[model samples]
Target: MNDLALRGDNIVKRFGAVTALDGVSFTLGQGEILGILGDNGAGKSTLVKILTGFHQQTSGTLSVHGEETLLKSVDHARALGIECVYQDLALANSLSIYHNMFLNREIVRRGPARVFRLVDHKQMRERAAHLLEDIGVHVPSVDLPVERLSGGQRQAIAVARAVHSNAKILLLDEPLAAMGAREAALIIDLIMRLKEKGGLSIIMIMHNYAQTLDIADRIMLMQRGRVTYEQQSANTSVAELMDIVRREYRAMRATTAQ
Candidate 1:
């Protein structure tokens, strides 16, 4: 097997007296999709936060390209070629597509020899257009404000930004949560294309088993802040996954019935 682009070993995180994650571990290989399935409060969000460096792991090792290092913050993770497209997307509603695409790292032209010092709107816009096109995004134009784009277009923009950054590891937190079926389909296809064409390593948190199974190379089931099971998508059926969920739920209900 190819080496994992990212790996988390025995990760732990806590909030006050609550242990949100306990010894969670996983590996994400390049050009592969790993789907995380869990109900609310199952540590799915916590895991993503820790992975993206939004929240520090209380203990454990996070290795990127087989090198273990401390990811102090989101900037550190980004510097290591990791970017997360959160559920809310964090897009700038008031900004143009190009501006939002290069929000922080603006390209600047310092007078004499085109020294990079200013927001290179020209170059950014060109790159943004090409990125969208390469991802098969059918946006009307790259210069328009993001507010003018459709929901699917906005999602495509978010994903394109992540891809354009040369992010080796992509963490997506329920990108399809509020989207309609059609829009979700488009986003899903875009994700698959990212893995197939862009060779991105992806970790997606999703509740929709069927959708997860459709594109994921592996599915990991999390319960009560712990991963209880994992299965290869090709070797497991949705019905089986549903049964696992149902069984776990029933067991929880039964325990609480006392």
Candidate 2:
């Protein structure tokens, strides 16, 4: 339990008359990447929202770094070393890379407080440059506007921002969605590098079984609001996942026809 970075037990969520998540449970070990796969309406988005503290579960329990937690808000989660990067990346395209890196967490001069606080631009720039370099994200300069970067670069910046905030458990929502092959490769390589570093735990809510299998240490498949399968990535193949999904859908169709 102590080595676990995050754990969810029998989690359930509902929106009035509709149930979104039903009895979902999982564990994320320290320095592990767990890929969560599911189709539309399978509660993937709901689960991610709950995990990131954007939404609360109607029932069940959540533990962060071995302590049961009730994450009050997104900021609360961030304060506890949990960060999330959604598909939009939440970047300010007109802002310089350094400014975006700091965002709401900008460093302020020591002498000032509140409304008079002065942003330490030079310090932020220096740290952003060093951080990008350390994480293998290449850009011409920290002064460049985020609009000048490519999709992969933007994605990397979003991820780097989470890392800069000292995230221990990262929730990634469709990190590679709508990317071309080369762009996807960039994010994939970055994920592998982070995994090799061995401190952060990640949960990627994904659609592509094969990509998730390639990148994650373990895989969990959800269907109609419940976890239907869980296995070590090394022991599962893409074919097996596809077969299981097919069977599940067929059974659902048969039940509907009866």
Candidate 3:
């Protein structure tokens, strides 16, 4: 079987006269993590939106497992085993952990009296507990509301929920943003564990160079709606990435001055 999980070729996106993404092309391998770094307006989010089916590209093709695909909608992306966990985490604070885990896709009892379509709360709770445990997420109780959990725990719940949903390619947008050192460490460890588990591909949008270097198998840097650098994490350094950014900034300043 081909080990390539996802590939984008010459992707372009335009909003009227504004070109948000300019011919971005990249490949994500199975069971590997690709970290994206960029300044504001670097087209990182735009590329991710297109990959996750939140937006359609004006031009370019996407391939999944070597098959060309046109991601029509977010649901269509999910149907293809693609899921995104954004910075917001998107959890219902008032709902129980299991309830939040099952969110839109709830389990229903199957029987003659199934017309009422009662949710299988028991099964959901058990499975939620199992999934959290499998992912090494610790909580006092699965029945507790998400509002009662800490930031790191809430983030873990979001990731675990995505994993439980059978996500093959996971897109995470600043998963560690606004987090303290301890909380960020928790999510970082979880991401590494997920990578070690195999069969799951991850694309992470990150701003922290140190953390990206630590977790990503490969690093991609974007500037002004285009990719400026791509390399294996093991072969690159934070200083090198900063130097690239500085050079780009200098060039932009020179052009504006002229």
Candidate 4:
């Protein structure tokens, strides 16, 4: 029970006449990285939303940390130690790194009255610096504007923010998207560092098969709203994954022509 962080049993989702997910099931283990691979409409985002409490599963059972329950809202998910860092990174470019780390979750002065609140910038800065350092993310200063940093740096900051919120389960959407080799390597290292730090489990919605295989302990491939294949990363190859996708495409083409 403690080994599992999350599990979904025969999950389904529908929007009007369109079914976004067709009986998908999966599991994420504690302190393990699971890479979800699929095409554009393979229900990856929908599953992510459901897991993060942005959307409810039409019919399924979801368990978080051995407790079978349905998440009510993003805050509910957060209360259960679930957090997501979307691809947009969602950082205010004009704000400093420390400010972004505490975005919408700022620390207020301890003795301030309800109506007279003031942000504790010094505390946030020191804490943000410590967190970043602990996570192996080194930057010039926590006071620098986020826009001044590189793409990978921005991504790291977003991840750090989720961690600062005390996330036990982290979901990353397209985490390595649109980055050069060096930048991608930076984030990969960060992800590994988080795993090594202990007590954090991650699910990455990814497209690059090679990268996923390299980073994930296990891999699950989705095709048109269904999980078609799943395997331990160590046992799978890029060639085998491409073969499975090709077979599915061929079968679809045959059905369409009939």
Q: lDDT by residue for model 1 over 1-258, one digit each (tens)? A: 248788889988989899999899888877779999999999999988887888999898988878897789999889888899988988998899988888787767667646535566788889888878888887777789999987877888898888789898889999888888999999998997887786688999998999999989999999988888899999998899889989999999999998
lDDT of 1 at 195: 76
lDDT values for all models: 0.87, 0.92, 0.93, 0.94
Clashes of each: 5, 0, 0, 0
Worst 10 residues of 2 by lDDT: 109-118
- Kindly give the stretch of ten consecutive residues in candidate 1 with the minimal lDDT sum: 109-118
| lDDT, candidate 3, 2-77, per-residue tens | 6789999999999899999999999999998999999988999898899889999999999987789999999999
Screening candidate 4 with a backbone cut-off below 3 angstroms (N, C-alpha, C), the clashing residue pairs are none
Check candidate 1 and list the clashing pairs.
107-118, 107-119, 107-120, 108-117, 108-118
Segments in model 4 whose C-alpha atoms lie over 4 Å from true places: 112-115
Candidate 4 lDDT tens digits, 137-187 = 999999999999999999999999998798999999999999988999999
Give per-model TM-scores. Answer: 0.94, 0.96, 0.97, 0.97
Candidate 2 lDDT score at position 124:
94
Instruction: Arrange candidates by TM-score, descending.
Output: 3, 4, 2, 1
TM-score of decoy 4: 0.97
